[model samples]
Target: MIVVDGHCDVLWRLWEDPERSFSDGTLQAGAERLAAGNVRAQVFALFVPPQVPRGQRLKAALAMVDRWHGEVVENAGFRPLLWRDDVPRVTGGDRPWALLALEGAEALEGELVHLRVLYHLGLRMVGLTWNEANEAADGCGEARGGGLTRFGRSLVEEINRLSLLLDVAHLSERGFWEAAEHYDGPLVASHANCRAVHDHPRNLTDDQLRAIAESGGVVGLTFVPAFLTGGEATRDDVRRHLEHAESVAGEDHVAFGSDFDGIDRVVAGLEHAACYAEWADYLLRYYPASSVEKWLAGNWLRVLAARLPARPMTNL
Candidate 1:
């Protein structure tokens, strides 16, 4: 079966350490690791940290996008997926594929034009915030707990117009609902877990999970240790959150996000991208092969086919 990780920070990692190659073995998402993990397709997020001064945020995001094209997409074993039709090519072959995602709107700098440009540059997904407030909305880490702004609503409309994947992994609770109010079709919490299980701000509440399910969306069970346990996390923690998400959202909405290169600490049995193969084995003890197949790649494929634009978008 093919494995599709809904989220990772390899570009962010490569961007941070300029000398490192995308295939560098030291990196968690290095070429060797991804090959060993057998992760046939992966989502690489362009995450501009909140502290980046407003003036330079766009440049920072663009640089990562450049690396995505230069490094990840240019690699021999990887292919970039920019259309709904591209899904079959990746899953049907041995070569790994990639989808681009923005972890926060801070990179857009309050401009819808930039959103279009990013989409044109192969950005298939957009996450509104990354743990701090931006023009779009308050992130989960924001104490004020506000919802989407007028600009945020417009951003959602633009995302809809472009047929981009909407991610709510770090939005504040109120912000999540407000965005949901205006955005039709499915949404992906690309790298979030169940708050009902771990109680982290990054995790989605049962209501949020159900909302995703009701909309025919998918939720990636992240491997962030702090979100899983008070200390080091294990595959069992992943199982618990997966089971909880399945219970509330039903099986269709559940899948793996991994949050691999983005995080510092690691889950005990899941140390890097390659470990996904092992994690899949751990999951099999508790689930049937068919169900495990969906959690690994099939469910995410379902979302891609339904959410991606049928042809190259020209609405702008």
Candidate 2:
């Protein structure tokens, strides 16, 4: 089966530690491990740490983008997904495809021109905030729980105009609703769980899940143990979250996000990408082949096909 993971922080890891090899098994979603997991395509998030000086955030993002170009894109085992047509080329191939995504709007530094530049640089997805207030919007961790800022509204419009996938995984409740209300395109919570299963703030509530379903978007059921439960998470905990997500979002809207290198703890039996085949087997025991396929990659494929631009655009 071809798996499409919506989120991984391997690029941030590579940027933080230049000596690390993507093929090395030390990291959760290393290229070798992704191949073993049957992951045909993976979204690599360019996450700028909050501590980075404000003026240097864009530089950090560009550096990670360059790292992606040098390491994953130029490598024979992986291809950078520059357009929607690139999606099918990964299936049955010896290697996986990589898609670039921005985890936080800080990279834009409150500038829409930078957003356009990043889009042209092959960034196909954008998340407005990480876990705090930014020039664009309020994140899940914000105490005031505000909605999208004036600039954030414009950014959302620009994202729709550019046909980039809008992610709501870390948006505050108000911000999420604001996005749902304005953006008239396919949406995704790249790496998140169902709040109905676990009360973590990072998890989406049933209403939020249904909203995504209604928009013909997908919610990537994440592997973070803390998001799954207050205790150690097992395959069963993962299963519960998926089951509840499917119930609320519908089968077509639920897919695996597996926060991979971005997370500190993983589900007990699913510690790395290589374990996906085993995880799929466990899922098969409960769901039919069709449902399992949707959860694995089909749903994400549908979103990509529907939302990504038909051809690469020129800012000129």
Which parts of model 1 are misplaced by more than 4 Å?
Answer: 313-316
Worst lDDT window (10 residues) for model 2? 307-316
Whole-model lDDT, model 2: 0.90
Per-residue C-alpha lDDT of model 2 across residues 13-116, encoded as one tens digit per residue: 98899889776667899878888899989999999999998999999999999888877878635777767776667566676788999998999999999998
Candidate 1 lDDT over residue span 174-236, tens digit each: 999988888876988998898888888888999999999998999998889988875788888
Off by over 4 Å in 2: 312-316
- What TM-score quantifies how close candidate 1 is to the native fold? 0.97
